[model samples]
Target chain A: MRRAVSALLALLIFAYLFGVLLKAPIPGDYRDERYNYYSPLSGREANESVPDHYVERGEEETGSQNIVTSIVVLYRGFDTLGEVTVLFTAATGVAFLLSTQRSKGEKEKKKEPNFMASTGVGLVLPFILLVGAYIFVHGHLTPGGGFPGGAVIATGFVLMLVAYPRFQLREKKVSVVEAFSGLAFAVIGLISLIMGLTFLENYLPKGVAGTLLSAGIIPLIYIAIGFKVGSELSAIVSHMKGGEE
Target chain B: MMANLPFIMVALFIAIGLYAVLFKTNLIKIVMGISIIESAVNLFLIAGGYVKGGIAPIYTSAPEGEEMVLPTPQALTLTAIVIGLATTALLLSFVVLIYRHYGSIDSRKIRGLRE
Candidate 1:
């Protein structure tokens, strides 16, 4: 009965979504006339062309050739900072929830996981860590970013705990990494302020746009983000896996 | 037909994932459904940034100019992937905790945590 109800609900939801999809205007075919009824300024030509100067300067000022990176790190640095903080808060919350000492009965009594799983995870661990670090490091230059890279690196800790149930992470050591990375992140932002720019502003030279070392604080900030994310994730994993057997 | 293949597949995968999430009774399966959705979205995001046969967004030489694939979507997808991992891990941990408490991995039995 529950399955039937759920299936019916799912069907209804999909049908509604399909209806909305059919009614929605396609991106390329977007027209002012379609949205005319919703406009506050009733008869105003309704379609206003945006200025190209900001767009053009954004292409040049941010240093990174990729327009998205330019906008993310330079044009909208504060939003990115907030996003990082959200991740940090989530990690903290997970750690807080999972942080608990093992009871007397559960202490030091570790059950061995399957040998195949252990060996498989062990073999894959380095590659995972490598990819994570690679993603973090190349964030500014490529498609990857600090958050993803950091999470990737932290998976190493999680995998270790899974493969070797006996492995316990010391919260103290992980906390140090977390704290230092966060501090470094704040310091980078402060440096921008000290240089007489707004908070998290790109005070350093916007190097020749498409090169590896081109975006000054862009790379630096991503590195800091990577460190922060890695440590935070590892800490969360440790907290979750550290307790009990 | 070939150009639209990836998008179609991704959309289908996402639909399947959404279907599984709503209908699956097992906690683990629901989590897998969520992961599948994440994967599908990642594929879509990556596909959105694709410039037909373009090189990596980096440039060893400047003369090649600026007609490259948008790196933003890829970066966004990468971030999304990380966030997805964190979410999935947290969800799995919750599932484990829920199982430990209820002695069952069934979602219907775990409704006690809802209120």
Candidate 2:
């Protein structure tokens, strides 16, 4: 009966998707001469007299070779904060779900797990850690960004836990990393206020574009995101395998 | 034909995943189905960002003002993959906990918890 119900639901979903595929409309932003293009209403342009140099300076103003990073970090920074909060909420939900059913006595057993799987994890974890960190640091200039890089880094712990069933992730390290990274993320945002901009606005010098050290708060935000995601995920994994407690 | 291959592949993967999630009796299989669905979504996203002849998106020693593959979707895919991994791990953990409590991994057998 459960299988049948699931099948019916699946069929419904297929029908919906099929219908959408058949009838999906072209997006309004398509550049076609025939279509009536909605133009943006003229708004108060920033006074050109104050500092015209900032407008002409494209990549140099952000240090990131990728314009997408600038749009995300500098232009739409407030959205990033909301994104972080969504992650935090998901973590909190996982914790709440897992903690409720944990048995009382399971908490007392803190013995270190056998090192059978630890040997293999110990061998490969450093490389994974290194790559994850590299991805986070070079996020602005490279293909990989903060969230993904952090996830890759977090997978190191996942690999360790899976390879060594007896080994548990050190809670102290996880907690410290999470706390500090989250703090740094907030601090970076707050500092934007100090720099005469709104929260998370770019406050640092927009060095030359395509340079390693460009994109004022972009790299910093990526690092913080990497750390935050890595610790949160590892903790989640541990909670999963933590079992009974 | 080749250009649309990725989209077709992603669609099929997602379809199979949805089937598995809906029809499989085991909770673990259902979770696997979800993961497969995530994989399909990620694949589609990455494919959407594909250029006819694009490099790995590194901006070094390239032609001036060259058109590059969209980076936004790649970034979005990374985020999706992370979210999928976290959710999958959590779901699997729940399955494990349920198995411990009921000694059965079958979803129907564990319906006792509902009442």
Candidate 3:
């Protein structure tokens, strides 16, 4: 009976979606200038939208090679801050809840990881960490940024945890890294204010666009975010494995 | 033909995910459904910014004359993806807590806190 209700609800949702899809045809490729944004800030008809402006003059204005990085790190920075906060909240909740609900006093005997799995992780772990570091460090000049890089780092740790359940990643140390990275992100944002610019505004010199060291505050912010996200995710994973209170 | 595939995939993904979420009795299956829904949304956002032959919005030795996909949706999707990650973590944690307390994960069995 409940399954019937669920199926009915799902069918209704599908019908509604089908109706919406029929009304609004999805374009495969948007190459038409007519599709260019109608600028609202300028109150002009079909004037350059924020994205068009960013595309045309992104390098000149932001000195960042990756346009997405410019938008994510500089223009919409405060929103990213909020995102970090949300992730932090989830990590904390996981840690707190799991710590409280310890799996009784006696720790279960852990099975040893197979030789192949442990050996494979040992060989691949360094490469994963290296690639993750490269991603965040080269965020401004590359496709990936903090989030993907951080995820990759966390993936390596996750692999370790899976291959060796007894392998302990000190929760205290992980939390320290998380706290420091979060603090570093805020500090980078505040430095812009200290320079008399708006919050998270680029204060440092934007060197040559496409260079590894360019994009000023953008790289710094991504680096902080990468570290914070990496540590937070690892801690959450550890907690899920029944970490101690 | 291929251009519209993304949206079609989006519809199918959402439909399946919705069904899983609405019909699944197991908490873990429900969480997986939620994740599927999130992926569908991400795909929708990305598809919203499709260009015929546009490249990524990066300038590092980019092709001399090529279109760049809209940066806005990608930016928004990035945030949405991370937020989804956080929410999923919380949801899974709740599932863990629920199992710990109730000794079961079937939603139908979990009626009240009166134990």
Candidate 4:
């Protein structure tokens, strides 16, 4: 049977992975304070890995207190931009696919949600939005960032959609939010380029490291990302739900 | 074997997902399997970057003399998670369309009718 063959194949793959990955060295054994990285450029054993440098010096170099934030928004910002583009493409595809199925969406007799659940969504949405905003705003100093913050805000919208089957997200407003936030990210990058720096390079002064105002363009980029992601996700949800525009 | 517990779990998760993808008949289940595979990959990346007793890579009010975990992997994982979300959404939309046209989500039925 196909199922039997696939199970055997999966088992074989698991065995191969177990053999290879289990033999690899354990990370962070605490026996070594210093990291050992083999650098191909110099063909030498270096005492510090790339991560070690990021941890030790990232704050001073990027003016961001969070090393992860520095890596995501500064060092690998081009990748983040690509990821956002991917999200946007997916959102557009979903909308395009579902937009043609208008007749079915209107015919289903949707049951009205109960009072408690509907009322609770109205009460809880603001706190969710506030937490999402806080997460992206303090991304340079906290564990949360643009993606999670945006997801949280989208969660609020999802809650609303689930509670009220008839609840509609204005498609125009959603697209405008998506467009402007996306433009904000690109505009910041263009500003950096016009200022005689590389694309997306920080143009503003790196303030004191621990403060909310620090990290130069890092927080700004994250804030932009938060808005962009939030709107795109909510738009996708609205499209999928077949809510009236 | 025990020292590699996290890696083993990651591999097992991936294997289970692979099995689902290969063996399942339902389109929706296949999408779930793909999402599971993404989660496993994210787990693998995080496990690879583990530093024992390491705190997050943030420097704001960080404890004195504590080691920080690798930042690059976590950043990469964040990217992966978002991409996974997008892919999952896209996949689900496709599944919905399939169901809409065919009135069923079973692969066997859909495959036979494909011209």
Best by TM-score: 4
User: What lDDT would each prediction earn against the true structure?
Assistant: 0.68, 0.69, 0.86, 0.88
- The best candidate by DockQ is 4
Tens digit of per-residue lDDT, candidate 2, span A137-219: 88778666677788898899889777765667777778788889888988999987987888887878867766778878899
Q: Rank the candidates by lDDT, best first.
A: 4, 3, 2, 1
> How well does candidate 2 score on lDDT at residue B67?
46
What i-RMS does each candidate reach, in Å?
Answer: 4.8, 6.1, 1.8, 1.5
Can you tell me which runs of candidate 3 are displaced by over 4 Å? Answer: A28-46, B1-3
**Complex DockQ, candidate 2:** 0.26
Judging by DockQ, tell me the better candidate of 2 and 4. 4
Q: If you superpose only chain B onto the true chain B, what TM-score does each candidate give?
A: 0.85, 0.89, 0.95, 0.94
Measured against the true structure, the TM-scores of the candidates, in listed sequence, are 0.73, 0.76, 0.93, 0.93
**Shift of residue B79 alpha carbon in model 2, Å:** 3.4
lDDT of 3: 0.86
**Chain A vs native chain A, TM-score per candidate:** 0.77, 0.76, 0.90, 0.90
Q: Tell me how candidate 2 scores on lDDT.
A: 0.69
Candidate 1 lDDT over A81-194, as tens digits, reads: 766777777776676555542334434557888799799998999999899987866665666667778878888888888788778777777778778877887888888888
The residue ranges of model 4 lying beyond 4 angstroms of the native Cα positions read A30-48, A103-106
Give the per-residue lDDT digits (tens) of candidate 4, residues B1-115: 6878988988898899999999999999999889988999999899888898999888888899998888899999999999999999999989888888787899988876653
- Which scores greater on DockQ, model 3 or model 4? 4
